[model samples]
Target: MGFRKGISILTISAAFALALSGCTSDKPAPSASTAPTASSSPSDSGEGGTDAKLEALGLDSNLKFKETRKITVEVYDRGNDGGTKPEDNFYTTYIKEGMLRDHNVEVTFVPVPRWTETEVINNYLAANQAPDVSLTYSYPTIQTYANMGGILDLAPILAENKELFPDMFEYLTETNIYWDQDPATGTLWALEGRLNVLNRINTFVRQDWLQKLNIEPPTNLQEFESMLRAFKDNASTLLGADADKMIPFSTSFDVGWRADHLTTSFMPNDLTDKDIYVNGFDDRLFLMPNYKEGIRTLNKWYNEGLVWKDFPLYPAGDTTEDNLMKLGHVGAFMHNWDYPYRNGDDSIHASLQRLVGPDAAYVAVESFPNDAGVYKKFLSGPIDRKVFFPATNKEPIASLLYVNWISKFENRVFLQFGEEGVTHEKLPDGSLKTIATTGEKIMNSPANIDYTITSNGINLGDPDLTVKSIANGYAGVDSKLIEIAHKITTNDGRIGKNANVGQIKAEDGQGQALKEKRDTILNKAVVAAVDKFDEIYDSGMKDYLNSGGQAIIDERKAAWEKTYGTETMLK
Candidate 1:
């Protein structure tokens, strides 16, 4: 924040004036360092000192090590699994012992509560104590950090070390790849940790509840509503007689309320066949006409007692199931397709199975018909959450190597499956037969998934690894549930028409500010009467534009036209 880029006070003043005068450069402003040299592969570089060793391995030049160094990183401790304790967690220990320690780089994973992740991260960033590698799903936060010089510029580092990260580079730069860029210069600055499977975005329903209520799974909107009512009516008998506990369509206002698939019928944006996830770069929400309709549906469900009553009061990271499902009260949930089976003995499936019997059942509602009878909804490519190194990091090189370690195939296999024979026995057929308590499905977890560092990102390279994760989940006696979930996700999932091509302009820096303004207005609208939706939206949009929303949208529209031309992208 104190000008590490070395621009003098006078130059800063000139830039500030230009910024205030509403002039933005078409390109990114220059940074302190020059572009870095590239390496074809790890073997292409010289060897000697720690710096030379990194170069020899095709790592970033900035990643230099001398003797033993301890590097601090942040990880999300969701408190869902006791074995996932951050300080001594299996994944953290794997990084420390399996990878970082050999290089004399000790890793201390700082635990940030998963529920308060964003707020906690912002606080650490403000104090300059944030992790060397950090992640967030919000692009606005990344832009704000880059503008304040809070994050390290990794474009040159990533470019130079491409050989060390072939899968990552290809996944990001390939035809349909997705990655973030510097708003000012449009250079790559951050890296994304991607999801291995696209099957996470479908609907999960309690099939046992349906059977008990003698109702078939809902096919369309009206039947879906009818199912919710049936769940509500039969709640006491099937889900224990707790009047306040029974929730038909469980969801949290903080996160789950607007899950793309849940509101696919609303068609949140006219920009595409699917929903345009604000990207946090475009800050264009109230402008989307059908967006309010999505909120209106939630409000209608809330007033009718279909959704969780205290949902609005829940904290950001607390999803609907966090409040109800694990307690065996939720009848239906629209979340990760594998929600029921996660968390082992403490998992949703385990708890629900305890109440019913060993033959607990869940079925995937493959594709829900929207009002127009379409199954299209927003689903991102491999990666959705992205990670970056902040400028305040003590050792950038160690961080990069740490990333490289996780990105490697063998290391990731260890983390994903645990110490092979100990946690898993490698089958001769090349598929994994998970060990009782230590495998991914039971006890092990991929490291730093919250920070966009994972085995998941690199798992795409091998067919063995590709099928292993699903095998871990599907290894159960009944593969029917997992198969149906996979079919629904791969078959009906949607992506943005131009997901990868959009540029982040300089004006996008105002997104965070406008987002805060919009959130205040949005809260009022979501709880408002259906008829009052437009009035609340107008009030919010008015404040947003007055406070710089118009500038952001204007620049974004210009950038859109410049990229695709007006003939393709309309106003």
Candidate 2:
């Protein structure tokens, strides 16, 4: 079946999507009102001093407003085609309408396709037709615009409405804001955004196949190898007549997704750990000894015929692995827990369950102990992008008001869901649920906005949600897999350091180059282990450590010293 059809099976049923009656928490008792008054004057309290009269528009705040104005805004559309609507465009209509209706500020939304978000936005800005606010994903882009004086510094606005934006303000302060300031100079450019801590890679296997072979889930590396061997052997027997029928184990390496996840197995520590700085530098791109070990593991798997030879060239989103697993051909793969749950497809989940019965499971695996025994989890920041305002904006206060209006909870929800009763409903259990208003349920309906817009809050590091979302629909998932995943914590000592100084200078080009180098070295090492482990180690392993590896350690050491002082570095 086509990938789209395969995914449709997992899509939320229209009935389920529309039936949004979840429990609700009792509303909090009203507290003494200390809300700030809306003022047009630049003197409004905030980061920088303001004396100019402020013209506010969009959603009116609870605080009384003096005057209101209407403005048109162009915003990127994140909703899929099936659910596209004027109000569904959160950045354009939803936010604009909420601000205008609530705060007596009128705003108009212009939708831009995701494929042309950057291009269309830049073009508009260049043509002096910029919107009040523009959204972007990359931090570097935001920094570039901010440095060019193309965007307003929100610091003052944030300060002025501190109570109105405690969570947002806290997020900005706790995370690094991109701006340049020099004690020696005068002002620095800084960027602000949310940080995501947990890296999403995890192990996915055919749990149903495990039960068919009566093999237990793998724990350490040895057990994992044993399971792979069984998978290969069983596939050989089942497809004894067909050479192409055997699916030992496989994953796509196209676009670096599969390769990156595979490399994580050899990580001696959590990639997020800051302890193992390069020599004395803090750069993480530098090579480390553990990288060699990871490569060796991959080499071993390849030589043993555990990994598919054609993996490196597979097209992304192709059904090769999915079909194999569904047909009970492949044994295991590595992917994020949410892969099976999203994109309006649940066939992967359904196929696994039907084939395996109840043996399918999802698990997370981590590397061994480090000096500190503390595993560093990757964190995501709040600011996905810096909102850029054009220098040509006749009234920047309108933009500020627009932003402030949407920052409110009610406005945010409106931007996410159309009319609550129409698009969704609160469940008896208080949990929010999605509902399909149209004939077809949108894959990422506004009801799912929390996942797409807001950063994971309490959901971070949660294994249960992980399993339920990814593996539960499949039959093979079990407790043993969860146990294995939970045991894998952050490793601190084995983290890699950035040592590619020459490459770093090239910016984006350098980042891609270093990644290619690392992958090449690692891939070779992994395949070599089946022949002579020693040869693999000697060739790529030693050179990587001695050259790039040592530099990384040195860099990390220096960084540690700077952060903790000379006395701590000595210890």
lDDT of each: 0.57, 0.43
TM-score of 2: 0.60
| lDDT (Cα, tens digit) per residue for candidate 1, span 474-568 | 33425667667767765645643433344445444564565556556656666777778788878777887777766665666566556555454
**Which candidate tops TM-score?**
1
Per-prediction tally of clashes = 3, 110
Query: Alpha carbon lDDT of residue 316, candidate 1?
Result: 59
Off by over 4 Å in 1: 1-66, 100-102, 158-178, 182-186, 235-240, 243-245, 255-259, 268-287, 317-323, 425-429, 433-460, 474-477, 497-550, 567-571
Candidate 2's C-alpha runs over 4 A off are 1-52, 55-93, 103-138, 141-153, 156-167, 170-199, 236-245, 254-289, 314-329, 343-347, 354-407, 410-429, 432-441, 445-571
Every model: Cα RMSD to truth: 7.6, 13.4
Lowest lDDT sum, 10 consecutive residues, model 2, at: 1-10
**Taking the tens digit of each residue's C-alpha lDDT, what string does model 2 give over 275-317?**
4333222122224335445455666678878887766654333
TM-score of each candidate structure, all chains considered together: 0.77, 0.60
